[model samples]
Target chain A: MPDTPKRTVFYVSDGTGITAETLGHSLLAQFPEFDYDEVRAPFIDAPEKASDLVERIERVKRRTGLRPIVFSTLVQPAVVAVLHRAEAHIVDLFGTFLGPLERELGMPSTHAVGRFHGILDNRSYQRRIEAINFALSHDDGIIQDGTLDDANIILIGVSRSGKTPTSLYLAMQYAVKAANYPLIPEDFERKALPAPLKLHRAKLFGLTIAPERLAQIRQERRPNSVYASLENCRKEVEEALALMRREGIPWIDSTTKSIEEIAAVIMQHLQKMQKYADL
Target chain B: MPDTPKRTVFYVSDGTGITAETLGHSLLAQFPEFDYDEVRAPFIDAPEKASDLVERIERVKRRTGLRPIVFSTLVQPAVVAVLHRAEAHIVDLFGTFLGPLERELGMPSTHAVGRFHGILDNRSYQRRIEAINFALSHDDGIIQDGTLDDANIILIGVSRSGKTPTSLYLAMQYAVKAANYPLIPEDFERKALPAPLKLHRAKLFGLTIAPERLAQIRQERRPNSVYASLENCRKEVEEALALMRREGIPWIDSTTKSIEEIAAVIMQHLQKMQKYADL
Candidate 1:
């Protein structure tokens, strides 16, 4: 056996396990090297269920002769009891907030909601707030429309340039209103910023990615759109960048950066360039 | 002083804590009983940081004179040291996996993704799956130019009918791609499903809300769209529901149901009537 214990995350949520997946995936996405299995412990509603889950984990450990790390979000009397004998490294999500929550609610507990906050510079932080608003509000308009008034930073590129996923990540994580507009062939013909963008010249930022990568993402959505073509993607991206530079709008290449990395850079830029009252 | 012990949840991972929140929030949303202060022990990159975070949590316990619960994802030996003598409720995330994740990557997991598997059957369970699919897709085309094919059901009502928020909640939580089409005066005059929805006859569902509530939600956004008018709202909802009944399409008056409740009802309808693939 290896020197290290095997690790598994048990997200024993009260309902479906996807919510845990969202938080867990984002966390795991940060550490590429840390490999772990995901278990959605559904219907962990009662104290007995929590304790049972713990006991099961213990049995598995003794049977396999392997001690594994356990992560759980179970809040029940039985869960609290089971914790006493949990053999592996434990991360009790419910335990972290039991005090403040109990005080606030004046109850031993009934359900669970996690209150996790991250601190950032006020100005930079506000951009994230607006980003979330923008992302949630203007769905497709984010791509087809070029208005950046609500946007702290505008990501412009051709089809399949990794715009939508990146925008979503920023908005979901930081509440950043990251509006992304695709530079259609028509825009490329004149090679100018869309007229709506003329008013907000300073806040515009562009993103470009590898042509092959762009093709891959596009292939999944509209495999037949000419915009997804490598030649078309490359040409449009090149022209969009040139236009952004000529218009004096800054740009970032999204070729290698993770969604988190991209969001962090954009947040920093928005703070430095445009600190607007986003809400 | 509060009588309950100060509750603390130990959220641990080698990665950032986004995924934990997904599971954490679901539990919170479902239970709504347990409340806790949150501290994320994220970026426990190496064994040493794990030790430090473990120590800090212990200190928090000592300073507060309460035993803290630990939710951790410690996989390294150095990190396990901090867990020692912590005397906390430890829930390790990775403990569910019998072996290291690396060994399981290519291996088929023991768990089921629930496709084509025979299990206990219930209408509610079936609807939950359908609702989840609806929330997952959030098909924009359903709303574009007024096409409702993307939705298993069409919600027709004025603004503040809680259409958008409800649609979003269903889409995000259950993966249901519910589309809401605002029924307007023009819709009644044309006396048909809005132009876009005319084509999708089978998978259309409708909703109507109280005029006052419509005004409330609309007032928050545009505050002035004729769509917000209670009188207009009432007329449109009434007309649209009539048209739906005339066309042999069914609808629900959503004025009373919470978003989840509304989603639940729609899920039932979809399962019984529409043969939509869970794909």
Candidate 2:
């Protein structure tokens, strides 16, 4: 890590700042040699806030003797002009893309601020809210019977195997009807599929974690208990993987994967399955 | 809407494709006059897959008699080469920035793929997972005792005013420990802050919604109930806003705001409060 140069990076936006961060992070990740101290400065809509941000960047430059890099999605020109006072490289995301788009469309832009996240009382927003409510109601095998009927995807996993967060993410981000079921000792003892899960076999995706990692996670919740024991974790993971294999379910190890990765893999798997069905 | 030109846009990635979508969406939002038909292609790692993607783009061009716009974050050179076969404007995000970064760092990049969403057994990952767990356990005033002590922020809103999703999003995306409290009728009738919430006044953020919109949202849940009536919704929204103003708690209307916008506003407010405390 010490071989790389250290620099300050700021993602500034008039709104959520997610766009600036996504673009900046992707660009910085490409280098992989610089150690970045990144900070997110969202809602810099006013000139005062922009001036304050510039001052902070100047302070960093003075202290480190290295110019900071600022990735900005500030739509207002007045606010954006204030940021130029900072001793840093400015990567203006909106300024780079908006001109081309306006020319292509043959119309002037609305110059809207934070339009990406502004709420509309439209079907898309309603569907997202509905999906979120459905995910929460169906979480952790809650109301297992009729709930699976509407689920676009059902995740099956052992305890602490990254099911809940992934389910919520798919629902929130994509409006996918996602439900999760936990495999317990009783199901492992049966050596057969749970009766309820068998009905939704086609929608099932399994998540498994390394036994050692699972043990460590479980220990945090129930320290020194049998539920957190390595032996119990090993048995559960082995049985869970076997169950998924026996049923020919596509599974991924959640041990070293983020919820984003898990959800993407599941979405890709679904798309493939849908394409096969079309044929 | 028909006055504007129609364009087909693709967000392509070698990983989850989220960054592509986020950045692309912000860019497209700037051109609100144009109607965009968007597709997301994720996990296109292999050259074969890239070839298929190019073929799909070619098909779109032939059918629409217009060129498509492809926003790609594909890292591998071989895969990117195949994509050039398509008749489209390729906005190569990674290729555009990677070279400059490599030059600045004075080192060649690892050229690693999918590093953005890949999980490492590091403190950051653990913190995110822990935050998610905390948000879930502390959701909706569940186990109200001592839970607020750990929360970075507490969201207060009337029922269905978009509290839960915002809370969960903050936890997942930013690793902020957020909890939400519903403003029940009892508290509104009393015209005072809830006793427990008063203890953590500094961390409180309020969400209100337009009465008509709230009525529509509540109507979906209970078609004919008084709880979903316009009169009831109007009353609730009015009282909620009054209460927030009285408490001097910072508030935003969730009626025309996405969860992302709501969270950003709250975060900015928190930062301002923190800076004042520092002074």
True-structure RMSD, every candidate: 10.8, 4.1
Q: What interface RMSD does every candidate have? A: 11.3, 3.8
lDDT of 2 by residue, A1-279 (tens): 454445888889998898898788777766654677777798898999999999999998887778888989999989988987787888887776777766765778777888785532256666777778888988998864475888888899898888998998888777787889999989988988788788989989999999999999899888999999999999999999999999999999988888888888887787777732210
Model 2: per-residue Cα lDDT over B1-279, one tens digit each: 444345789889988898888877777777665676776798899999999999898888787777888888898888888887788877777776677666655678656688775432255666778778888888887744575888888889899898899988888777788888999888988999988788899999999999899899889889988999999988888888899999998889887778877877776776677732210
Model 1, A1-279: lDDT tens digits are 655544565555444334444444433432445555544455565667767877877876785566555545555546555654777655455565555545543555544332221121234444543454576555434443345566755677666555655676666455666776677778768867787666767766777787777776567657878867778777777777777778777777877554444555666576555473231
DockQ of each model against the real complex? Answer: 0.12, 0.53
Error of 1 at A10 (Å): 15
B13-102: candidate 1 lDDT, tens digit per residue:
554444443344333443344545556555465656766776788788887676665555455545555665476766444443324443
What lDDT score goes with residue A22 in model 2?
78
- Segments in model 2 whose C-alpha atoms lie over 4 Å from true places: A1-6, A31-33, A46-56, A76-86, A100-110, A118-122, A275-279, B1-7, B102-108, B119-121, B144-146, B189-192, B275-279
